[model samples]
Target: MSEFAIHSILLGSAFSTAFFGLFAVLNAVGQIIQRVMLLRTPTWKRVYQKKQLDTRPKDAVDQLPWETWRLVAGVIGVIALLFVLWGTDYVYGSIFGLGAAYVPSFVRRQMKDNARWRLRLEVRDFVAELRLALALNVTVSQALEHIADRSGQVTTSFIERVRYHVERTLRMESPEKMLEALAEDFQSEDLRKLLVLVRAALRGGMSLAEALAQSADSISQNIVASAELSIEEMPTKLILPMLFALFPTIMLLALIPAVSMLITSLSGVPGQP
Candidate 1:
């Protein structure tokens, strides 16, 4: 209705058109750069992540060396956006780009947690199988060969590698060394410690049953402690946003009108003064 309101609407419309125009140019430039990279054979292959001749998921997308290229392209996009708009607009673009970049990392973190849990469940059965082999007076190599034969069992590959490597150690006359190598290859803290214990037991002629039992117990306790610690710390870590951000905004929403009324009442009480 007023001149001020009319001018404000016009300014808003101008800003919207300018923003959309910049976005259109940015989108076109991004597509052009992508196509240019796709022209060269190596560059095209890097962006697309084509698999090798051997087995693996065709769409796994393991294009590693292209990471540098992606980073460069991202930097270029942000710089272009900032120049086209302003420094303030760069913040918006950065926040959006960062979220897109970290989507894969966040998904991988969750997947790793699930993978660890699956591995732990399988390890429980594995420990039981190993104990049974020990009870039957079967050598470690014999037990592992039996484990490797269990088709569709995910742990079979690891067991087969260890069994094959250990068998080679038997010919070389260094079983302890073989155990050490197994620990390194497996990349497992529990397995590495267990191997160290195995070496010590072999050297000192300690009871094998006692060593295996202790290792299993130790691993289970560590898992329990880890779970407990995570649970306890979660509330403390979670309070921050609620305390600093959400709580204040909510409180202001509830109190702002009442506070304004109180201020008006106090200001209007001037006749008594």
Candidate 2:
């Protein structure tokens, strides 16, 4: 009888300790996610310098979606972790499994996002290059080739790809048509709108340099407005989890000793004293 009671106590203690540790770790992870979700991630440049990176300009123009990948990886990770912890004390194996599945997709998403941001920054520069070449009596095709040679950074991008395609496919296509084709390959709405205005300038025989400057100024204003909106909302986002978790945690910490004493007293007077 005594042996049975001791074994039962041991089992209970082991499970309690395991559950307590798991809940604490999981809660910490939740807090991290909540905090990160609130961040604006000003740019994706930092996410670009990791593994599975293919910096091909063609690939940059068309990025793969990662939300579905997240769902698949999460399911697989949970299954794998459940298998590992079935009869083992290694409950933390779940953390390793989830991270293994998540990190690659996260890295890829960041790279694509960063690439989009760079595209935004370089839009004005691209227009300036085109306008300058036109001012110097260069043909549209010649200007594209020159931009490709001069402006490429760590990765060749939609700009370079469009330049190469125009040189090969349609030697007679206008500069506006080339930009429109480039916009088709890319998913940027701003670029598409700019391409339309550029095409209109060409059709109406307007000054190309003036049109480019106008479009560039419009994009700059949009970027500033977006930044201001993000800043205004940051305080409320930052407070949400703290109010929900940290405040309660502080109260629990303050009340813990009294709660413990009440529980002890309620256990029938501590051996009849």
Candidate 3:
């Protein structure tokens, strides 16, 4: 082989080795981190307890378990950033490996977004069930208990909690106070809005059940409108994927045989002897 060809081969081998080495190192680092976390249960518990004391909302405490991992990730990021500053050829790989640590949180956020949509639908159903029960002349506490029997798995515990508070309120405390607590526990905007309307109607001497029935109608209508809009927009959303993903594969498939035949014909047309 010529010097140029030899050098090209060596360079390609080096690049491949470096790429595979970096990937292996990243995977090893992740495994090491996981093992270390598993071994340090006491340390993790201490940090979790401290975080729980410091954080107000229960939801915010979810991040506490990842604190050690975040710290490890930050250290890795700093090292990668330093390596990048050294002007190495694999600087981009280092940066990417460093970013791998953040993948869990990003994935968690996406899952949470999907969960939020599902939870919103569940809340809508809960409200509609309440409306139906109220329409049948059931008292609020009894309505909550009735829904608890037939509600979705997602809202069953919430329904039971609400029913518990309602029963307690009837004996000693105010039902409004329990509703306020329930709203806080769920941290749902729709629940809060419904509570506000219900609270207002009760304070205004209007029928609480009737007001909730109207609110339920509004919620159902809004959900239907949203679904219709999403269906209407589906074709627009699919345009880019069809243009980029499906189009290229199809063109390649259509041209491959013709291109191969042309190449074969060109090779057959050798220099005339």
Please name the candidate that would achieve the greatest TM-score relative to the true structure. 2
Give the per-residue lDDT digits (tens) of candidate 1, residues 29-127. 998998786665586566456433222212123343334434444454444444334422233333334334334444555565655555455555565
Q: Comparing 1 and 2 by lDDT, which wins?
A: 2
Model 1 reaches what TM-score against the true structure? 0.51
* Residue ranges of candidate 2 with Cα displaced over 4 Å: 1-57, 60-80, 83-88, 137-139, 152-155, 170-172, 229-273
Q: Per-residue lDDT of 61-177 in model 2, one digit per residue for the tens?
A: 245544455445555465544543462232233334434454545578568767777777777677677778778887666887777767656355756665565675447766666
Candidates sorted by TM-score, best first: 2, 3, 1
- Candidate whose lDDT is highest: 3
For each candidate, the alpha-carbon lDDT, in order, equals 0.53, 0.59, 0.60
Candidate 3, which segments miss by more than 4 Å at Cα? 1-64, 85-87, 151-171, 203-206, 221-273
lDDT of 3 by residue, 57-171 (tens): 3343254455455545555555555554443333434534444545456556656666556656777877778778878887766677677656436434455555555556533
Residue runs of model 1 more than 4 Å from their true location after superposition = 1-94, 113-124, 151-160, 163-175, 235-273
TM-score for candidate 2, please give it. Answer: 0.54
Model 1 collision count? 0
Candidates in order: C-alpha RMSD to true structure: 11.8, 13.9, 11.1
Models 1 onward score TM values of 0.51, 0.54, 0.52
lDDT (C-alpha) at residue 144 in model 3: 70
